[model samples]
Target: MVWNWQQTDWPEFRYDSAALASLEETFLLRAGELFGAFHHVNPNDRDTLRIELISDEALKTSEIEGEILNRDSVQSSLRQQMGLDSETRRILPEERGIAEMMVTLYRTYGDSLTHYGLFSWHKMVMAGHRDIQIVGGYREHDDPMQVVSGPIGREKVHFEAPPSNQIRAEMDAFIEWFNGSAPDGKSPRPALLRSGIAHLYFESIHPFEDGNGRIGRALSEKALAQNLGQPTLIALAYTIERNRKTYYEILERSNKSNEITNWLVYFAETILEAQANTLTRIEFYIAKARLYDRLRGKLNPRQKKALARMFREGVEGFKGGLSAENYIRITGASRATTTRDLQDLVDKGALTRTGERRHTRYWLANTQTDQSPIERRGV
Candidate 1:
């Protein structure tokens, strides 16, 4: 069927109340409270957290594009694309841009009562890599209907429109509504709902020749900040990457219907998941913090500094231990001071030594597990 682009008006779509209700149920007051805590973390700490989350999200999204989706491979792709000069390993470039953008979004939210500038959000993502084209902004070229992949193993489908020069105009209108008119002047919708809608609207527009999905997702987070009063702490990108097919299918079905209920519902559910995961991480951090605190009375300043650094950078090698040399570099302490600190930590039962003599290193006294016993206490 030849679809007429000019004939497609967003108002023709209907909102599904049932779907919206289901979506709202997912983000009860408790979820919001948890998300608020996640938002209060330091921006640098948040950036560090996102480095892991976005790396996983980008990998998962790539897998949706039919590439192998895993932590290591995705990390490799990110390293080269981002030009992160590493002393030992590669870092993903997208993570850098995403982290930087989120910080800007968060800072902007604090300063303005209404932080819904599409250009500002767009500029944040564009700052690092304009050459990437960001996937979903208005197209300057042929402006053909954008197609994304279908159900796994199925052929891709395009959002086709009858050939017309007004393709650009159609795209522009979507952006204008998306960035400007969608939120009424009075009580704006909650950030989560607005973000969900922004995701839907931008995808429906299919504005860019490429990178629409990535940019659309980014816009969703920006909307979340404006509506929710906090930028995201959860890894919603990872959630979408995990349920890529369901995500697209919901969008497709909802786009054909009136009120974007299904799409919004799905986005809400994912937000809940992302928020929950973030809470889980926060619990771990608190637990870890307490554990570190418990040792503070037992540790000297040097030992405490070294341990703090270890927690931040993560333990290295399969042994999951640090050497005297590594401690010296991390603490910027003298070799004798590093040795004394390591020995003191070992004496205090905060760390344990592994290997013999020259090959020896120190590891956290506790064993590593996905969810530490301390973490279960919620710190």
Candidate 2:
């Protein structure tokens, strides 16, 4: 079956009152919940800190370009690109582009909304997957770009070429609107909605030779933080990856019908799902942190210092879970001193011994309760 490659008409996308109302209601409720989760500081229940940590983990996880571009390889390469450790690897020019893209996003946060910001994004998208057959280069040549897995897959395209000039102009217009929209006296577009719209439009434009999907997703974050002032905590990529087939289908459906309502709904629902998943992870981590805090009294000064270092740096052994080696490094003590502290900690029940000998590690003791054996032992 041949699928039609139709152009989008911006004028047709009017907000449906009922849909808008429903969206508003949902966002309001979500916003309130998010605010509480992020801002409410409970010393005994440090859920907000966990939420922050989980969000960072999600960002690192989602930054990788998986199977849509070799999932496993992309992740492995991306970690190298992050430049966090000392390891070095040779990168293809295209892969370098992806690396640069990850760096820009991670470092800049929401500031990547300016003209320069958009260009950097486009440059990386083009660089990352310039050789892919689906769409390559700014101009369409003798080879018609194939749209696989759609009603139009394997069909020869015989339509007016996408107007590059018009695309450039429309993109600029959107940027202009976005940069100054808050001051323009127009009722604010919801940040979540704006992110959805930006994704839909960028995909509709499909400007790059390849890697448009990843670039669009990256830009969606920019629109969220810049246009909406909210950093996206959910993994949109994770959700889309899970439903890759439906993802394309929904995007195609929106294009064919020029109806954004369904796309908006899908995008919003994915975000909500992602947020809910994040909430669960945060709660679990918070519980772990609370358990660690409760066990602090059982720890001596050196053990407490070791535990704090583990929490601050997230070292392998000290991640709310302590170990003898961690105690040695954290306290800057000799092996004998560290060993004595570890044993004392175990006796006080501030740490529990697991495994055996040098293989043994200490963990927060009695994580479920605030009681400490140190106080009981009068240590």
lDDT of each: 0.56, 0.55
Question: How do the residues 259-294 of candidate 1 rate in per-residue lDDT, one tens digit apiece?
Answer: 555556567767776666556656555455557667
Writing each residue's lDDT as its tens digit, candidate 2 over 1-379 gives 2222353455245444455455546555765566465554475444235334423433343344342243333434555555433445455555455556755675565552565676566676556443554332343344444344435556533222235545556566656655543323254566667667778776666665556677778766666555435554544565566566666667776665455777777776665655554454444445556656667556667777765554443212354355566666678889899888878777766567778876787775543322111111100
lDDT of 2 at 216: 79
Q: Give the TM-score comparing model 1 with the true structure, all chains together.
A: 0.58
How well does candidate 2 match the true structure, expressed as C-alpha RMSD? 11.0
Clashes of each: 11, 4
Please, what is the TM-score per model?
0.58, 0.58
How many clashing residue pairs, candidate 1? 11
TM-score of 2: 0.58
Q: RMSD to native for every prediction?
A: 9.1, 11.0
